[model samples]
Target: MARGISLNRRTFLISTSGAAAGVAATGLAGTGAHAQDGALPEYAAWKDPDALIVHTDRTLETRREAIGAPPITPARELFVRNNLPTPPLSATDDPDVWEIAFEGVASPATMTLGELKRYGVTSTPAVLQCSGNGRAFFDHEASGTQWSVGAAGNVVWTGVPLARVVEAMGGAAAEARFLTGTGGEDLPPGIDPLTILVERSVPIEALDDALLAYEMNGEPLPIAHGGPVRLVVPGYFGVNNVKYVRRIALTPAESEAKIQRTSYRIRPVGVEGDPSQPSMWTMTVKSWITAPLHEPSSGAVVIQGVAMGGASALSSVEVSTDGGETWQAAELTGPDMGRFAWRPFALVTTLEPGRYTVASRATNADGDEQPRDFDPNERGYGHNGWDAHAVELTVS
Candidate 1:
């Protein structure tokens, strides 16, 4: 069994508060005395309240909620994603020394981290979630990390608008549709034979709302969480949020990098193909119920979860108390941040003590509704569908 799975009650309370603060700090830096310190340090262990919510990416997906309201995952509870542990660089390593280079573009250019920040930067709260977020839910064994539920999270990310950065590297033409980003991570042997060197890219249109963020939760980013800089695609999976970014190239072609080529793509729906099959690039409409703690609770229970689409607007969210046998509408909240963010929806309901299953289904205006159960994939690349959580309630 994977040991990185557990959240206790105490931790939950703490994380909840921190997440709330993060929501408040969205688009702004922290005003706390330690505002200059940076976001909370990664937990010694990746555990949360109830020992039920375990985050392999150090709670990177903790920023998301189930149904009620969208709470900013505070720096404290914000998820941490590190392909590798924190790489330390001394303060003396001149901020001016941090430079970014662009290749495979019409006009490649290099700029220091400081210079990039001075460019057209803006802040927005986006949900940076992992493509394999719900991998554990798959019936078939997957190849990569078997994340149970907490592999994804949402946060108030602050950074320069991606489009502005591209414009700085020589204006983009209408034909330039893809932007490939090469980061500093190198693949270790025996991982994936076809693994593209830790590089990833997205369609240029996706950059309209994408961000080249250097700050997370309103402070200089921690290296463990893609410090220096990273890409934040508004509605895409976390895999697309390439960390330790060193390059951003605008191209008129599609991306076939290792990460984009071998991973993150989804196979045909309703069919279980080879895990290693090449497939579609778009993400499916998805939602999840997060409240009632998935545990049976008596009296009024608040239900909450998030819904997202690839490049579409979320239309509606529905909930089912008795599994999917019956459904009721849930109140949708939050503004459509972009392709990389999920909208929060919530409803309050009363429950009787007993075992129960709750689910949330989201639909995008494009008429794409989440499936009750998505076809299990061999690679567990995409697991977006209706989220069904089972909880037991006891009453005296």
Candidate 2:
């Protein structure tokens, strides 16, 4: 069985020559200190105490303590997802020297991090959500992380446009249909190199809106997330945003990488055959109740949470205090961060002592509302069914 490799602060070492050189110069190995001496503290020490380790020490999920966090998720409160062992911070100590190799263009090129910055920088607020955010709620368990509602975050990313880099590489051929990105993460021992790679591809058209971000939420990107340089695809699932990005390739065909062809794709339940389904791209509309973790004692109770509209702006959010039998409009809070960012919503109501099922549903400007029941897919890639997010609460 394929497994995710786990690495802790103590067990993780700078194994690559490029990283070793950076570590030798700065002594950052295992120190948890980011590139510029003490700009950011170590990952283990800075994250919220309520953060849950979803996968070996590498992946973390936000808990109630971080549910109502600001529009821009703090570095410490941001959730984490890794396809491979976390790259050592030393690998990104000097953004100036980092190089990204490009191929399959009219003029294959290699651009230095410094040169890449010459295109100028832009910032945009967006949500990065794992495709499997609600997999845990599936009646049939998914094979990977069983995330609930905490496997997502909204943040403002700062970086150069990916289109700029593509332009610098002499543009793409008309036949190039996909833009593939490769990360610096290492594969576990004994894993067949041919079987998989930490790489994924997006439609070439997406390059115009994508960003190669070096700064997230006003701080230098941290290794825990994708630091030094990570690809940010606004309005797309987190898997499309590659971390520790080191290569960009214009391809005539989509990536044959395992992550692209086999994993991350949504297929009918019990589907069989290779290349069985389409890959997941844009996220589905979804909402979650963050505050009042449990049923509040009788009388008046206030409930709050977040809603995301995927590719469209959120039109409204409705809360149901009694299962899906009835739902009332909830007050949407926070500034309009943009079409791709999550919006905060709240609802207050007086409840009588009893058992209740509390749930929320988000509707996008395009008139797509959350569904009461989303049929299960084989891999559980996108489980946005409203019933999956309902919580059971009992008031004394």
Candidate 3:
């Protein structure tokens, strides 16, 4: 279980009031931490007005109304998840000057953003999704932010291949079993540092597809989105793609970083501190409806959604207007972004004035299909089960 913070309602109200006053006096928005310019990044306020702020003002989840955005999520509208408060690194406008330390190899080295760019750049379209994207839908509430279905985005990442960087650093040692990444975000005051660091690790095998991305969707990565450089692990959950990445180390064993070994692990109900339970890695097959933002008027309506096959390619997505009793194939729309990006699907139908239940399910090329229900787990690390994503809507 996570530790809790205690604060009297009076004290909290007073503190917030004072903060708002400070912001007003400074002519700055009260939405996010101030950057070096003494202002918040433009992207910081790009979210929908109804977006859920799961953690104070640090993490923002997009609302369902904005889920079916463009093929590539707009930089300003992309979801934001910060393990810690976003540092004031926005003061540094020149991404070329940012540096990353590489250690634990035959030749420990460091690479600046400028130097990293010399390796040549490559672009790949992929999806970045929170490991707990659908945690809010769980029958039992889970720790952390209770997110519904909008904690994901599809973007084209432009960067240098991590494998090349590893090779440039003299390659990995024979004993190296994991590649750990550490971010530059700072923890809140009064919090213990040793027990909580925004660090995570992936198996050495993932290096082949990992990247040190500097651009997203053709734009320079914004400060709110880990500008300059961030790790992009294709096919892995968003947590594995550390933002504000500062260091990369080759280790003989998986990182013992709290987030790597404990927080992201999947433990069964009533299980606590069990090392036997494995940590989350690749996401599971999942799909969700995005259209019919609300109750629709009777007539012709279009239902659209997105599906991801996780490590595999998506084979098909089906939609059912009569609950899960029967389903019809949804037309797979949009150009194929890539094997790692979400695929869009749509279904059009006529409806009468009445209430209806709609659901969506996706199947992967590997023959894996979304389940109708999933067993409850602690922390809600991975909610992707056989359960179909269903919504109740009224037509008038």
lDDT score for candidate 3 against the true structure: 0.72
Q: Ranking by lDDT, best first? A: 2, 3, 1
Between candidates 1 and 3, the one scoring higher on TM-score is 3
Taking all chains together, the TM-score of candidate 3 against the true structure is 0.85
TM-score of every candidate relative to the true structure: 0.74, 0.85, 0.85
Model 2 residue 235 lDDT score = 85
lDDT of 3 at 55: 33
Deviation from native of the Cα of residue 379 in model 3, angstroms: 0.7
lDDT of 3 by residue, 167-198 (tens): 87788888998888888776667976646888
Off by over 4 Å in 2: 1-44, 188-191
Task: For model 1, give the 10-residue run with minimal summed lDDT.
Answer: 1-10
- Candidate 3: the clashing residue pairs are 370-386, 371-386, 371-387, 372-386, 372-387, 373-387
Winning candidate number (lDDT): 2
Model-by-model lDDT, in order? Answer: 0.59, 0.73, 0.72
| Candidate 1 error regions (>4 Å) | 1-70, 84-86, 89-96, 173-175, 186-196, 252-257, 267-282, 294-297, 333-340, 387-396
Candidate 3, superposed: residue stretches over 4 Å from native:
1-43, 46-55, 89-92, 187-192, 385-388
